[model samples]
Target: MSSFPDYYKILNIPKNASTDDVKQAYRKESLKTHPDRLANASPQEKKTATEKFQAVADAYYVLSDSQRRREYDALYSTRSSSDKSDDPNASSTFFNTFANMFASAAGGPTGTTGDQRGQRPDADHVFGDVFEDLLRPEVESRVPWWAWLGAACGAGIGFIVANIPGVLVGAYAGNRLGAIRDAKGKSVAAVFSDLGGNQKAEILRALAMKVLGSAL
Candidate 1:
């Protein structure tokens, strides 16, 4: 499971965003993703909108409070530099139940029951910097942020399920999906607008993975 939701990313603000910025982002995002705005859309679209609404609400709830936001930001920094051992949930030696609980809390799929847990022990370390390698500024000036975000998420989820093979496959799938969105010339905000609950769940997971790569 990931450490915490990437509130900064969810709100589309920088880590150094001001309180006013948080408030404005919340208002804008809430209005945009509010389920009421999608009443006439398909059931799936409505459900996705609802999930995004809740996720946004969750991000705002944590970020609006100065004390909580301070603590969350500390945890965010710690998780980036700490090794897998510092995080029992991210550790490869944890129990399936604990892993599942953290995974669920981290917005991972609920369909991971009966799946393998902690098989390789070192899978997370493998390809740890894949996102960093691909996301360098020289790669492309216009590649949206979510492209790397989705890729990091793919790798994080892969660590939880199939280990090494899962990481490779997940990264590829995430990259492919992001590529499709890129080809369509989607902006970061636009891509996020169409994402569902499962996709949003990966936000923090991707952030942690990304920060780790940068720290290394």
Candidate 2:
């Protein structure tokens, strides 16, 4: 019998992981397995990393969606219970099943052959965007108004206490402190977590539209 792929295991996450956990896991796994990270490695190493990257993306795609996760959990339970350990066609079987599941969910035709289904456009699409985004990292932080205030207050206090040198030192220290407190940067995973719901959906949708338009 064919076995379903354990997405939770693929992502190194628990089955009971929340959506945020799933997003964090994906970011972690994808970063580790990303193709660019293996650019200096051997061809075989690069190939292995690519496969792992693709698998991580696939797992994330399913587990990140509430409806898809529920459906996958049900099918996963059913298949895992009846699957034989020695099944040689497990990989192909699971690919077909997974493709069909997404197709059905998207209201797309599911009659495509295993080869066609296994050529996952959505996974490739996701991989492209993820790599591109990773290449151009973003930091969600800004210098708050209090930084200037802190600097001014520090300068005033220092000038009264000492002189020009004290004012300079005080202003520098105060500004640095305020900046450190207010301009706390988020990690890539945290950025991904923050980009949940509409922001993420809009990004993917915009990419899909662009791809479609380009193809046409």
Candidate 3:
């Protein structure tokens, strides 16, 4: 009898893991097993890593959603019970039932045929969504105003002491504005337009310090 994959086992997470826990686990596992990270490894190693990465992404896709998770948990529990039963046909029946249910849930063909039984459209869509979410910037809590002020002051002091060209400093500051927005979770342009001249200068200063500090 065909067996269903244990998603929690794939993700190395507990069955009762929270949504945030699943997200964190997915991020950690994806990074560790990413194909790009295995480029320097042997072909076999890269192949194994790619499979593992896909499995982790699939597990996260299922466990991250409330409805899908509940359905998976229920299916898993029933399958477990069926596996322990002494009836010869119990396991086969369980697999067939699950395949039909999974196919329906995934919006694919619902038949006992191997191709239909293994279809997973929802999994593919969820995988894409997970990757997209990972690529996008999330809004984070803002840093304190005083912290920005201090960074600006420190950057200005560094520039003066190093005798850097004003044009270069301005260019560096401009480029770092995007980083500041990502870090602060706000529009850099909006901040400048809404605040007074001094505040804008401080923001630019803080951004410059951030870029310079990373370089140093």
Candidate 4:
């Protein structure tokens, strides 16, 4: 229970306001201090508006509900004239504690709970972060270990498949050529013919250059 909360003052409702009066008070407060409306307000004003808005919202929540309002009235009247600073959570902690203390207590706030986020578990959405922290670097990379081996094997197989026909043709042509030789002591003409028509011409031109200098 908060000391001197003055729900009437908080909601701008008069001392003798009724249920509808409490609701209208809350509607007006919500309109004025809702975060969207206060976005352009100065920091000090925004803070003040936030406090007032919270007070009004809490007041409306209790006053609008019949059973809750009765319990709230008891607690509010008990604390209205009492000292505050005595309890840290005085403004926010009363209802749940009061209900737990009183076996017969029961009720949801009438139109709005005013504690929407407070009622839900904050760690449900946060659990995944804890899980991510564990699995973060443990999962192996797609390119790691045997994946590289498989890629290398695939590349080698593809290279051999691509060159097989040309290698066979070169061997066949080289075998058909007689024992032509160069200083290397092998069939130079056969090797040139194995390089195919254009390559053989290029080889002949290069050999001529070697024998006769640039005039070749």
Q: Which candidate leads in TM-score?
A: 2
lDDT by residue for model 2 (1-216), tens: 336567787888878999988876766665556666543689988777667766776677778778778987887777644452212134334655565666535443221224343334354566555434432433223655545766888888889878998799779646644443444453334554666574465444434434442210
Residue-by-residue lDDT tens digits, candidate 3, 87-166: 21332344334434555454444212245544332432433344434323344435544335434654675577565564
TM-score-best of 2 and 3: 2
Question: Residue-wise lDDT of candidate 1 within 45-137, one digit each (tens)?
Answer: 877765665556555655665755675666667655333222222322323322333332333321122345312212122222222222223
Error of 4 at 29 (Å): 1.9
Report lDDT (Cα) of residue 186, candidate 4: 39
lDDT of 4: 0.44
- Pairs that collide in candidate 2 are none
- Higher-scoring candidate on lDDT, 1 or 2: 2
Off by over 4 Å in 4: 1-4, 42-45, 80-90, 93-107, 110-216
TM-scores, one per candidate: 0.37, 0.49, 0.46, 0.39
- Lowest-lDDT window of 10 residues in candidate 3? 207-216
Q: Which ranges in model 1 have alpha carbons more than 4 Å from their true place?
A: 81-216
